[model samples]
Target: MDLQYVNFFAVAVLAAVIGVTLIVVHLSQRKLRAELTQLREELALWQKAGLHAPRAVAAAEPDARPSQAQGAPMAPAPQPLSEEQIRERLQQAAGAGEAPERYRHVVTLADKGLAPEEIARVLQVSSAEAQQLVRLAEVGRKKS
Candidate 1:
């Protein structure tokens, strides 16, 4: 009778372990299925919104006209200022009594294609202040 009881207890423990394992596996599968369904729904919504699909026109077409001559060399675009023109403008600005020597470096930096942030770093000023200096230089040039 004791042997019979030990055998039954062993079976019961095994059954309990199997039941717990099955429950865990079932819960994991259920979670995965739910996530897959949610992802599928989102994919469908994206398709309906035309966000997931490519358009009929894949890319813009190029211009039909020939851009260059068959044998002739291409000419460069005209610069905003020649060396002489720049000197004349600077002389004129000085004569007209613009901001003194202190601000000339700011204009030179701007003319060299340095951004306002970089100019600010070089001049030890805020970007906004540097931009103001650039604007003043532009207005001065326009006036000249």
Candidate 2:
């Protein structure tokens, strides 16, 4: 191909890539918005019903090892964790810096005593990510 033709092709390819990227981003935003709407509905229901925490949930077992892990000592599930216990678990899971605003929100929720799993659900992030955010938030808190 002529050098001029090659340059034109490259520019066209770049434009196509940018267009595809924009479409993908728009779709992702729409999906996230839908998730947010669903979360709001759930929150409203929870508020209207005056929901309370169950007596015991997995949050209590901070040190409890998974039953199926190799060579790990399996422990019985502990009783339900107190608000403080849950908050601590969430905070301990946090770290610092990648997404300060998001992590800050995670920390706030953790302080409100939401379990890591619950925070994960509401935020549409994985439980591991939620934990990490909490840890980051704690580290930031200590520094400031």
lDDT of each: 0.64, 0.63
RMSD of 2: 16.7
Q: Against the true structure, what is each candidate's TM-score?
A: 0.34, 0.37
Give per-residue CA lDDT, model 2, range 50-83, as digits (tens). Answer: 5432223444453333434556563443355455
lDDT of 1 by residue, 1-144 (tens): 699999999999999999999999999999999999977875565465444422122242323223455553544533355455656656676887865543676776688787776665555455666776676677668865
Instruction: Show model 2 residue runs off by greater than 4 Å.
Output: 52-144
Scored against the true structure, residue 45 in model 2 reaches a CA lDDT of 49
What lDDT would candidate 1 get against the real structure?
A: 0.64
**The 10-residue segment with the lowest total lDDT in model 2:** 49-58
